[model samples]
Target: MTSLSGKNAIVTGGTRGIGLAIARGFLEAGATVTICGRKPENVQNALDALADYKDRLLGISAHVGKSEDLEKLISASEDRFGAINVLVNNAGTNPYYGPIVDSEDAAWDKTMEVNLRGPYQLSKLVARKMLSSGGGSIVNISSIAGLTASPLQGIYSVSKAGLIMLTKVMARELGRQGIRVNCICPGVIKTKLSEALWADPQAEKQAAAMKALGRVGTTDELIGAAVYFASDASSFTTGAVLTVDGGMVL
Candidate 1:
């Protein structure tokens, strides 16, 4: 296992699913973690679930789309765990599940606000702190959807593709400053956010058969990739996109 001892990390949208898995994996690897969700109850639930870590795990309620909230989350994380050296931009949303031409303006705005803009703003804030504190690593959780567009995922695919580009830009700009930026593009993970694709019996079977592994990915399966990015194991890896998609994209 990759070790993150003495590292301070922050995970957004960490109340459940992949974000929660990444947070737990970070703690298991011996890092101090601060996680945030948009809801108070979800934050509390995650706090309770990770109680064994005690103060090592801090849970906060913050909307990634709000700059003030992001500021507060970062400030509180630093106050509790010192300088954050690992940042996981995992928060995202796909409010619409329809054709691109039929999509409304509000859907596009919200999708970009949470999926792309939030990470852009947060990375800038974290990179400045990282520069002051020596260096850090950033892992953006994009999706295979970004690599290949599918029906009903047009806006989301665009936003995620933009995120991948953002990762590359940040990595190139920050490499000399010691900050490594990379992206993970997962496919058909079994999470609530993807219930529409995996919940129905027929759809689930089709989804499974599409993957080389013959099944959808679990949240825990993405942990190892995240750990790699958070640890020195990926010290030389930047501006790269790791796909953990069960070969569905292949």
Candidate 2:
């Protein structure tokens, strides 16, 4: 098992889906984890679910897209865990799904705000903190759509692509300080955020068929990549985008 017994981590949008899975993985590896979601109720619910690990878990409510919320999140995590060792920018939004030509301005702005701006801001805040307390790893959760386009998700795709570039920029700027930055581009993972693509039998089959592995990826399958990036296993792997897409790009 990858051990992170002395580590402290913060995972945004961690009330459910990929974020929740990542938090669970960190806890299993013995890291003290702080999870954040936009809703206080959801955060409480997540805390309740992970009650067995109460001593090592902290749940906070914050909207990553909002600067004030992000500030509060970082403050709360630092207060509870001392210093953050791993920061996962996993919170994202896709408010619009349609042709790029028909996409509304508000939809595009909202998508950019959450998917791109939020991560950028959070990474900046966390990186500064990490620099002062030695250094740490920052993992940005991107998507396969960022590398390739899907007609209905143009805005979302664009935002994710920007995230990939942001990861590189952070790595370049932070490497001197020992803060490694990287990204994960997962394909059609079975998460609530991706239910629109996988909930339908026909769509799910089509998505699976496109993959060389012949199946949509499970949450567990992507957890290893996250663990590898977070642990010392990938100490030399920075500014790299690890794809857990079942060879869909192939």
Candidate 3:
């Protein structure tokens, strides 16, 4: 296991699903973690679920789309855990499940705001702190949908594709400064955000059949990848995209 002992990390959209799983993995790996959720109750719930690591876990309610909230989350985390050594941009949303042309402006705005803009804005803030601290690592959670467009998730695909580039761009710009930026493109995983793709009986079967592993993955499966990126295990790695999709079609 990759050790993140003594590291301070921040995970966005960490109330449940992948984010929560990653937070738990980080705590177990010996890192101080601060997770943010949009709802206070959701944040509390996640905190409760992760009670085993209460001493090392912190939950805050903040919206990634808002700059003020992002600043507060960062500031509060820094004040509590010292400088953040790892950042996971895992918060995202796909409001519309339809053709690109049919997507409304609101859907497009919200999708970009959460999936793309939030990461971009938050990264900038974290980068500033990282720059001052010598260096850090950033792990972005993208999706295979970003690599290949989905008919129904058109807008979401576009946003995630942009995230892939964002990872590379930041990696190049920050490498010289000691900050390593990488991305993870996960295939269909059984999570709340991805339930539309695998929840129904027929949907589950079709989704499983599409993967080379003949099945969808669980949240825990992505933990190793997250840990590797966040820890020094991949110290020399930057601007890389690791796909953990059970060999699903790209």
Candidate 3 residue spans exceeding 4 A from truth: none
Which of the two candidates, 1 or 2, achieves a greater lDDT against the reference?
1
What is candidate 2's CA lDDT for residue 229? 89
Ranking by lDDT: 1, 3, 2
Error of 1 at 4 (Å): 0.5
Model 3 lDDT vs. the true structure? 0.94
| Ten contiguous residues minimizing lDDT sum, candidate 1 | 46-55
lDDT of each: 0.95, 0.91, 0.94
Best by lDDT: 1
lDDT of candidate 2 over 181-221, digit per residue (tens): 99999999998888988999999999999999999988878
TM-scores, each model vs. reference? 0.99, 0.98, 0.98
In the range 201-229, model 3's lDDT, one tens digit per residue, is 89999989988899999999989999999
- Candidates 1 and 3 compared: the better one by lDDT is 1
